[model samples]
Target: MGDGLLVFDGRCGFCTRSVGWARALDRRGRVEMRPYQEPGVPESIGTDAATCSEAVQWQGRDGVRLEGAAAVNALLDTVSGTRIPSTVYRVTGGLQERVYRWVADHRSRFPGMTPYCESHPAECAS
Candidate 1:
């Protein structure tokens, strides 16, 4: 019901593009974004860095937490004038998660940061 914070992978180019899209759509600036890798962020978000690394996360002013596609839906919730579409998208949990997982699985192929994962390929594989 208040400000929404989205924590995402800053190093991934794909993730960066996605954040830009969200920001562009939300003209009201209702959503704020921060990289999960930022210091003191995970603690503030009531999560750990490891979990945030795996998927996106969201925190509402009411203290509700959502992850992955659900976190995305939370961001979408503040598009200024897309309530119905957002509700519909939010309700489809299974489909959203499947799509999110698929994208995450292939993040390197998407429009994102370079060197998606150098030291550990598995880090970007999932």
Candidate 2:
């Protein structure tokens, strides 16, 4: 892979936390994170930053794009070569996708989420 681009909502508390976790797991910085709101991002892989704030995305080698579960899986692929236990998350499939959607949809109601969102509501995309 040229480099893994993890497009995520920079304003989301959960998203920020996850990014921190991933960064810690891959201290070499193999994955590059770009806020979906960045200007000039290509739309071919669904790069509408505002809209994509509600989803997960990962662009892999050869421009293979994965969303939701597959996106999470692709990110794991980058750390697989390291000491990270990739197999531990083998089941991030359909079920996980549904759960992800649910949490994302209702994230505003989650504890500590309101304060986080209030601090960056402009980027939260409602």
Candidate 3:
């Protein structure tokens, strides 16, 4: 575990669930998950509210920063049994990013998705 950080949008249900899925695979507890909306979180991570609103952010223990699909890939790399898919994701040129953007844009339309903020306003209040 490198104490890596995964900053996501707490207001997005899809994002929260997606992070849960990732956490399930993180048997080693290599990453620390944080909601960007948390007080001082964005500034602490050298990012801004606007940037976090647009995409997920990953900060490695070594200080490397990644965003969007690349950030997802970096998170995957921390988990075992993901080498094949991670490689495919990396080799897909720009396709992975396009796919990520599409999914992000339509995330609310996904069945069973509900923003965490909506369901847990007290915990997500800014």
Candidate 4:
């Protein structure tokens, strides 16, 4: 209901591009995006590097945690007023989770994808 945080793999090109799109849709700035690789980010978000590496993490202002497809649905809920996507994900009987996992597993194979660190060198700089 209030502000939310989305923790993602900063080095992933697909993940970065997806977050970029989400940022554009978030006109209200309800969600904040952070790279798990960033120093102290995982600890600050109450998540560990291993968990974040497996799936995107979303922490609601209410302190509820969601990961993978659920996490994406939560972000979508914030940027858009409609709950149709979440509903669809729920009714699909784990299909959404499977799809999310597939994408995560093969993210690097996507054609034309570039790692965020490579595309945005300055941003990834330590």
Best by TM-score: 4
Estimate, for each residue in 1-126, the C-alpha lDDT of model 1 and write its tens digit. Answer: 247888888677788778878889988878878777667777788999899989999998788888998888777876655566457775788898999999898988876544324323444333
lDDT of each residue in 1-126, candidate 4, tens digit only:
358899888888888889989999999888889888777778877878889999999998889889999999988987896777678778983988999999999988774357666766665535
Candidate 1: segments with Cα more than 4 A from true spot:
113-126
> Which RMSD values do the candidates have, in order?
5.6, 4.4, 2.3, 2.4
Ordered list by TM-score, greatest first: 4, 3, 1, 2
Report the C-alpha displacement of residue 67, candidate 2, in angstroms: 1.1
Tell me the tens digit of each residue's lDDT in model 2 across 1-126: 246887776666677667667778766677876656555443645567655776878887568777766677678778555324235445546677788788788765654332334455564445
Global local distance difference test of model 1: 0.77
Which model is ahead, 1 or 4, in terms of lDDT?
4
TM-score, candidate 3, is: 0.85
**lDDT scores for all predictions?**
0.77, 0.65, 0.81, 0.84
Model 4 misplaced regions, further than 4 Å: 111-114, 118-126
Error of 4 at 126 (Å): 6.6
Which candidate, 1 or 4, would have the higher TM-score against the true structure?
Answer: 4
